[model samples]
Target chain A: MTISWMDPHTTSKESRSCIDCHTDPKALGLGAGSLVKIKGSWRLVPATSKSRDRRLNIPRLDGFVDISGKPLVLTSRKDLRPFDAAELKRILDVGQCLICHKDFDDKVMKNWNSLSPPKPCKFFLKTR
Target chain B: MKKRTTYLLVALVTIGLDTDSTASYYLGAKIIMGGNNSVVECNLAKVEVAGSNPVSRSRQFIKTGSHCCPFFVQENFYMHPRRRLLTLAILFFSLAFHSLFPCTAVPPCQAAAVDSPSKVSTTASGQIDMCLSCHDERPDRAHGRKVLGCFSCHLGNPLTGSAKLAHKGMVLNPGELYIVSKTCGQEGCHTDQVKRVKKSLMATNRGIISTLRYYWNESKDHDADLTVEKLLKSDLDTPAIDYYRKLCGTCHLWLKKHTLPGFLAEKGGGCTTCHFYKPGVGKDGKKTNHPMITKHIPMKNCIRCHNRSGRIGIAYKGIYEAEGYGTPFEDGDVSEGQLSDGRYIKRLEPDIHFKKGLICIDCHNQKEIMGDGNEKAHFEEQLEITCTTCHDGRQRLEKIFEEDIKRPKYPLLTNLVKKNGNFFLKGKKDQKLHPLHRFLDTACRHPVHERLACQACHSKWVPQCYGCHVVSDKSKDQLDKLSNKQTPGRWEEFRSFMRYEVPSLGIKKDYKTRQDKVVIIVPG
Candidate 1:
């Protein structure tokens, strides 16, 4: 599934894109899927518009990612900059989604979906 | 009768009576007339005298007795003069006989005439010719007195006492003098010493064989036929061997012939004959400037160090026993009081100092003694004056540690400190740093270590470095260029520095090719 998010703050012609926070492991809620597991298994899920409406977890997921992965997404976060394929590959490779999600099995997916959301996301989801 | 008549006639002749007929007749007539007439005249005179006086007889007698028979008688006798003439003739004949037959008493002229033939010749040329007849054999008498000739010593003219000839202006006797002087007494020449040296360690057949073996070991071609032995024995013109023999022959002869105890000869008078400080290219392409002059130290003086009696412990085993100490003399064992002979003496602790099987040249070298100038003057100045020439003061004290301490291990790091800070470290603390770091710390201090590597400064101990780095292609090229570029007087320094210093350093710099490349992991 494809994921999208709105600019939290906008002032000039160049506004923040959804990929800025969601794609970067350094940003809040960016690495939430890496932390949660069911039946000792983990999976990465793309966020839908409905899921974005339900929760705004940022800080909790960021803590789950290793420090080395934090700077990867910051390289592509600026809006209106030229889209770099090599940079996109580097980000996807670090996220592990390109490899894990490409050949997703039903059983693995079912276990993945059953897991509880991380604290930052659950907090926002409960509040909503 | 005839015999009697002959005897009478001979008697008459002897008496000078005229035997010829005419003389007989005149004699007879004179005798007849004079006998009678003389007698009658004498009688008449007497009678006349007698008649004159009564005592005429007495008077006549008196007259006859007192006077000549008177003038008348004389006149009558004169008329009969034959008698006087006869008497005169008899006297003349007697005189003639005496004159005709001289007695033993004769004049000198008559005697000379009778004894010798009186014609004699006198000439200067004839006398000179007589002299030349005997003396002609010895012409150029002075020239003949040369040693080559018989007259070399036997000088002077045989004939003339006036003139003198000598073996003048000639210096040496040809046969005996030249041979003895050239072979025995000439200052630097020593053919007899050469003969003696042949029996020495350096010049013996065995020595040549060993040297050849050493050379063969160093060479790439290892074929037995091409070995040093074969090369020496094989009639090949090896300039290296020739050079070795020539240079080694000089001092080796002295060692063999002159010194007492004869240790050099026993060891090999040619100790340095084959074992010179030779410079050449090493396995690595570097120059090797071996200090050639250093190996030629007179072996007689080696006793100062190498003798059992020497103070420096220069003996084969002495140095090893003296290791780890400053000077052997510094310790109480080598006391000033005990050294009656004035040589430096010390108690040698074999266990602590001895490196059982070590050679002296392994540590000491001529370069250290002679310096880089390699001039005769410099060598003479430094030969036995300094301790560092034979001993590495730093290594002996264990100040720098490049190699394992063979004996008498001492703490060197404790002594070294940063001049800026007195902070010091010992053993492992100091050893833990990188090799380069330790090198910089020790070598970069105030003097900035003129010799960069441990081997460079301790060259006498580590002479192999010189062999490897002295004559490489690069250095040869540099030397060739330098030969052309350097000014005349200043060139020797450049040559020496290049030949000795550059090569020595090059060995350390080109450490990759060096055999001593074992990486030492300092214990942390």
Candidate 2:
């Protein structure tokens, strides 16, 4: 799972893969920001804090898009991990990209000079 | 909620104490900076005037105070290098900040703004009006309400600050039938809908009129409108039209709104009859926000007027309301407050789909409810969405469809793909994994019954009210000379009516085909 966002539960788990956690609707990238299905039609909750704050920060989870340019919007408070501030900071503090994709620690150095944002999936999967 | 009032601080700087010099000048500047974006420096302490008097100097101020919501200074070129540069930079920054982040916009509980004559919020000044001064705590929902403003639906002058003057011509709710076409159904709004709704059977009472006329020997014609709109327009005496006004008109959405505290009088009209009407529950009315706007027009709203007439909406809930409609206090067998928004628990069993939590929208689409611009004389002419349209195809297959796309629940959702006469729902990827009755494809499905309308078998009940009599009496109210339609005091009333709720059962003949017919319907 991607750790660009500040999430604690994603870091605590020992296993982190691209497909596993990304599949869950609760994951930041999976849900269409602010939209929830209601009786087969799209009912917009304009009052939701995410929509009120304006643009949805959809992070680019796929390599085809740039992460910085497309942050998956943090629309609803439901997107936040159901934990207290203290607990969230603990999970967030210990997290880093190297925790899962550890072999690509060398790739971090290249992001500084790269013209565009790094695509983790393309960088690692293409090599494999 | 304790609201935080952001007060605008206006700093007026006037320079020049020394009055003995060689130039004609009277200079004073007013600068308004919101939040912390812009700052003004007024350091010119001394000046000399050659020729102009203090009275003549007033024109140079430019009179820019009108733009102030709280306060907005007009744009002017500054002679000083530092002042000019500072003013230019501040104007640019303030312009961007003013439009994007409205100074008045904040937490609804903590937002406040002075009624500005210039900048209303950040958009149009006269649009939001001074209504925000009092109801400023209420946040504007983003369904184009900011553009439309409070005056759009609620007829009132938002431009005025005074409570009395502002509400001079205000309508508590734009639900009245006579005014609906110009208000809620006004141009750029639901204009087309109001037009069709005026002509629809619900408005025209075509079904009741046509059926009664046919049964009563008034006419042998099958035209639904013959009983109401046709009679109202004809040169015939008041009895025919009054018959509708007393008995049939009560159920139609076009019925005039009355303020009586009873179950029926307080019922809504026009768009509100289906969308936003509800009776007051308690004396204080604290629990009920009467003019509630909701798109999910609850089933209860439909049953308000319908429960007594055809009872079709009530029948959808499987309620066969009692057969007596008499006594002023009690209208029907269903007690007051029993029909609610959340749930209507009843002994009468509803359709299976209703039990499965399928709402009316599952079958009826936009084109069905709101006409397709091409006006039709009747509602039966509009219904095209059906059951087999979704069930007949390869069905709700997961990931892959063996057949093509067929009848979609909503025909107006034209973006959806339909293949080889049928549309199949995709699985987990698109959330179209609706389970289908695969048994429909088997030989035991009875090919001879294939043409039957789905509701003929599926719908468990149809609410029908019986034994309705018309009452003609001179109305207590004085003459209504304005419209000159109804003579003063002369009108009809409906008080005693009987109802019978029964299960729906019928033999389908030539259903869904060229020779479609579902006759032999006992209204009850």
Candidate 3:
């Protein structure tokens, strides 16, 4: 119930925009997933899965489609992990993003802030 | 047939050109030996007399075309003797030689091979690419520095414009195991390296052979102890050879560089093991000549052979190409992972080093991977680098292994050490000294996990496919439904893969010793 999407008064237009939801660390599964699990009587269990996203609170890649029609994004759920310390520059930096994303394309995140709301792209599944 | 004709013509011209003293020469030996033992009446030179010579005789018809004849049999016969004596001597010589060296034809039961061109190049300079006659524009070769023409690697007649003649004795992929030595291990080139590669695990596939043989109990001897040369030369039993040829044969360095329908066309051979680029793609959206011999090797090249069995290179990158999946991830599938041309690849992961722009050669020394020319029983024994070798900068390893990192091993650790004494690696950006930094003082600096390999802790994932089902003879259709490739003889393998991207830790077992060793293992 913490996210805006969870709020009872959330609007349809906001849900449609990928940027409004995905770019947010909390909106994406980056935040601890579902604080409580029902063991017998709704006990609060921390979500400590072994996925890269779980160990470190992060999205590993910037979403961009490649030349031969291959996107660099992790397509499988098994590999969802926090971007390691090494991947920081590649994902966040302006020069590296432009490699595949191109200069100021329509899909470019306005300010392209990862922590901000991300644009709605099906490629970043569950990230939103 | 034409080669024989050409050689015959050459020998005739050579003998014909020398009109000095009388010389009885033996010809047509090559034609006879070329499996063309069909007897033919040969024309021996006539004795030119003064029209009234006392020993004048009719033309002597000599039967020939039986076996291979060396070019210099006329040397000893020039001593003496007149017309009939010389003719009699020459006839006697031909009969003796033909009887000794019989031209036995290949039996009809076995497939008949028409001819085999001599394995000789026209020139030592490695020039003359018949491929260049049509493929004139040399896009880019991996070994461009050598200035060698196409014929250097692809052994075919380069000067001849005719496609068939040019392609004569031409191998589609010189990188294939059968010819890697001749193609890559030429006089001045990768001779020593190719020698070692013939023995290298990647080429010989010693570990896989031993493991499968032991696992199946096919042979008690297993031929594991024999050197690669011995193993190749030794006549293996039918079941063992069948197992090797059908089930496990495709990955060996001898495997040809051709593409199966749903597989990458991995160029298999000595230098091309790491050098020859596969499935070459250009920006123009057209296929180009992918024959490259270069140091700029990508991880995918290693995966072509290493992919299914142990799955080392792909595991290093965290991308497991399980058998169920259609295509193993190429560099295009993982690293550049995407291009803005609205293209994307889904199934892949990069190792931590790869993510940090470190390639396979970054950590592994060339000589170490290629071997220092000494043959070892197991490839694992030859590995030089370890976790401590780079991160720890610790003491020398026991005398069990060699410890020397070649100069310019990689740009990261290439002699460019920092002032604090620890080796420094140049970062991808800003030329930052990404020191092979050891933080022992602050971190847990104990030997708790010293026995564990570097991959034990650092590896993000290890791919383990439970059932590797290879049926030796698909034609037989004798499938042991319960048994995988472990069955004594079967070829076509169809196994469902169970991928464990999560770090899979296991207690290492030494089959040779028949003991459970404490040595830990992941997907390295």
The per-candidate count of clashes, in order, stands at 18, 23, 39
lDDT of 3 by residue, B435-508 (tens): 55443422123232222334433444445443334545544543221121233444665543344433322233
Using lDDT as the measure, what is the rank order of every candidate, best first? Answer: 3, 2, 1
Between candidates 1 and 3, name the one with more favorable lDDT. 3
Q: lDDT scores for all predictions?
A: 0.26, 0.38, 0.39
**Per-residue lDDT of model 1, residues B320-424, tens digit only:** 222212233454443323222233323322211123222233223333331323222111222322222212433433333332233223222222333332222
| Cα deviation of B160, candidate 3, in Å | 4.9
Q: Which ten residues in a row have the lowest lDDT in candidate 2 chain B?
A: B1-10
For candidate 3, what is the lDDT? 0.39
**Model 3 chain B — which ten-residue stretch has the worst lDDT?**
B57-66
Compute the DockQ of candidate 1: 0.00
How many backbone overlaps does candidate 2 show? 23
| Highest-scoring model, lDDT | 3
Model-by-model DockQ, in order: 0.00, 0.01, 0.02
- Give the interface RMSD values of the models in order: 36.9, 28.9, 21.0
